[model samples]
Target: MLDILIKQVKVLDGTGNPGFIADVGVVKGKIQEVGFITRKAKLVIDGNGLCVSPGFIDPHAHDEGCPFFDEAVLNKLSQGVTTDISGNCGQSLAPVSERYWKENQSVHALINPPECMHEFTSFGKFLDAVEKKKIGVNMGFLVGHAALRIAVMGLENREPSLAELEQMKVYLRESLEQGALGLSAGLLYPPGSIAKQDEFVELCKVIKEKNAIFTIHIRDEGDYVIESVKEAIEIAKRSGAFVNISHHKAIGKKNWGKVNTTLKMIEEANQDGLNVGFDQYPYNANCTYLNTILPPSYLVREREQLVMNLRESQFRERVKEDILACREKWDNFVVNVGFAGMLVIKADKTPDAVGKTVSEYANALQKDPFDTALDLLVDNHLDVIAVYFSMSDDDVETVMKNPYGMVGTDGIYMKNKEKTHPRVSASFPRVLGRYVREKKVLQLEEAIRKMTSLPAQRLHLKNKGLIKEDFDADLVVFNANTIMDNADFIVDSYAPNTGIRYVIVAGEVALKDNLYTHAASGQVIRRKEF
Candidate 1:
């Protein structure tokens, strides 16, 4: 008898292989059989002719901020995600310190900020805590450059001294040695904005020495997108770093077709024997703090100085002038598309502001959209999250079809039904439902591979991406015909998908019929360092 037997399912082995009917046996937390199985089991689940594939791996997730806040990561589990790669866009959860608490108060408080941010001091300690806590899904991480930079030096906008740079390298090397799979840089974010190309190459050198990957939120996704791509590729080439671009997108209407040029550049880089890839969520919109729209120069000062500048009329006039004089040449998305592109999804102190666009709020207040945005940021102390309806469906699909492209939420793990981007709950299933099933943009097998093996390979997880006999029994069984995402804008963003029948983490059932079993069976996925 087996621990569990899932019988008569169409198995998509997650290798981009055609689906075939098979029975799978699970025992002692790993797949014991993958073909013909006649033995009885302690528990048997008739798959009801559903499709079983390896559990999806989300390559970009911000849930690492405080995994426990997600309450079993129900949103992700319902969508078939079993492993999440966090520590993205220059923000990670570990190597915590008081300065991190101060610098990130607004960002942290916005998402159910964890009370224990200061407890964990190193990557290893953080992973240990995660294991002890027993989170709901597997986790992998990249030590973020922004966090490390702050840890070593305050959020100053200047080149690191030779000693300071070496200290940063030491911290990164320690993180990689202690199970971090890679290094990530949010070059567009403050503190990260100070990183010059020479600095990136130097950091990538440390990452390359450990044979780990380097993932970057490139400096610009709008006007300077092409140049940013060239710089990212250059860092990879010069440092011998295996790099992945995070949440790839072209953010403005004018830049709608730029991904074509970016993809070609990445392809040619691969041809030159360099490893490069990108991940994208299937939404035409993006979510980030409202302060991100401000010039990085304005944020380079101390926190007190930043607050003073926001209140000063002269500074406001300067910002207003820049906003109006904006050419598409700047990285500020507000200037690129104007304030109308920003839609407030969550504003805790001002709950009434949720579900409204900046333009709408501005019009209601009879103020310029720029001033309304600035006032809100000042009132909230820069703690606001919004969605940018900046990308085109055509551009999103074009990037999605690329062979090197994998899926990532670039989304937060929301615990509420508050107006959040639907990608939070529906990204993977949306791909299956809207893109794969309805639109036929990609075959079912191909889409599964992108969500599974492609991300596993990128993270260097040898055992987690496929449904082989000896692999861990992390799997999802769902109805192909009925399977589709039900989440949408605002209220329905919390709605679960329609077809996920069962989710298995380590051979035990975690979700049966889209309801979480509250099983803390997840493990911290660490790098296999030599």
Candidate 2:
């Protein structure tokens, strides 16, 4: 007898193979059989006409530190995500001193930042705590290089000495040995961004030694985009480490059509004996703080210095220069608001400003958009907000078809039913539903591979992203044609997808009939270091 059995289902086994009719049996939290199963079970699911595939894995996400105040992860489970990798862009809730957590009150208060932030030093300890807590979804992590930088060297902009670099390497090695999937660096953000190529190579060497991967948010994704990508590829070559570029994109209008160029470079690198991969959310616009367009020079100084620059009489002139540089390169900088498509969501403390665009707010207060952005940052004290600008839909389609690419949600699992970017709640569904079903950019089987098997291979997850017998029983069942994401950027747009009937994590049903049981059966997925 099996623990659970699903009868009369079409299995899309997640190996890029054709689907076939079969009855799958599960026992002891593992798939025991996949063909015709003549077995009795404790529970049985009639999966007639439904499509079953290996659980989808999000290669990039930001749900690590704390649960969103809204319990909308069901939005994810309903669309078939079983595992998610967080700690991207060198940010997570970890490797902190108590003083640090207390000082960074905003992240802690809202993210409900975990105890692991203060208790752990090595990546192994972090994983141990997650297992102990049994968080929602299976999680894999990259020991954020920014966190390590702050741990050793405070949030200062000085170059590390030989001794400091060696210390960082020691920490990286400890993390990999303890089971970090790889090393992640956000070269577009402070501290880590200021790090030179030699500094990055030193850190990546530890990842290489453990046979883990190195993922990076490139230094620049706008005017200097190509150069920044070249730098990352060079680091991979010098260190001999597998590289995963996080949310690969050329952000602004001037650089809008460069996707093919970037893809070609990546393909050529693959031919050059480099193990390279990338993940992207299927959207044209990106969400981040409005200040992301500023060059590195603007952020080189301390926060106080940044404020001083903003307030000084000569600063406006300098700001004008920077803005002109941006304007020349990009045709239009849309200050998107709620209905305008670039919505403002997730400013937890203040909700009044939720639906207003930069232009709208600026006009109401009689200020320029640039000035308005700085004032908003000061008012919010550096809290993050979402930005949705227009990206060519064609670009989204072209990138999704790339062989080395996979999918991820750059934001958290949201459930407020308010105006927000669709990526937060609709990424997977939009792909499996709209893109694959409506447009036919990819076959259902191929899309599942990108969302599951491809990511599993990139992260080196064991016995997952497949429907093979003896593998862990993480799975999803849905009506492919009926599946559609209802989440949108308009009012009350947080509704879950349709047609996804069940989601199982480690043989336990976390979602049944599209409703989550609030069961936290997930484990911390760590790389096995030999």
Which model scores highest in lDDT?
A: 1
TM-score of each: 0.96, 0.91
How many steric overlaps are in each model, in order? 0, 0
How much is 159 displaced in model 2, in angstroms?
2.0
Off by over 4 Å in 2: 67-75, 97-112, 308-313, 326-342, 347-350, 413-420
Q: Best candidate, TM-score-wise?
A: 1
Residues 1-530 of candidate 2 have per-residue lDDT tens digits of: 88889999999998888899999898987999999988899989999989999898987876665343433344456668888787788765556544444333222233345543567655666677676664666777777787677767666678899998897788778777777777888787666667889999888887778888888888867666688778888998999989888888776666777878888889999999987788989778777654444555565566666765666658757765766655322212331122244355655555555767766666777777666666665566556365666566787888889988998877654434445566766788888888899999988999899988898888889989999989989999899989888876556456677888888888888888778777777777878855
Lowest summed lDDT window (length 10), candidate 2: 330-339
C-alpha lDDT of all candidate models, in order: 0.83, 0.73
Instruction: Give me candidate 2's TM-score against the actual structure.
Output: 0.91
RMSD of each: 1.8, 3.2
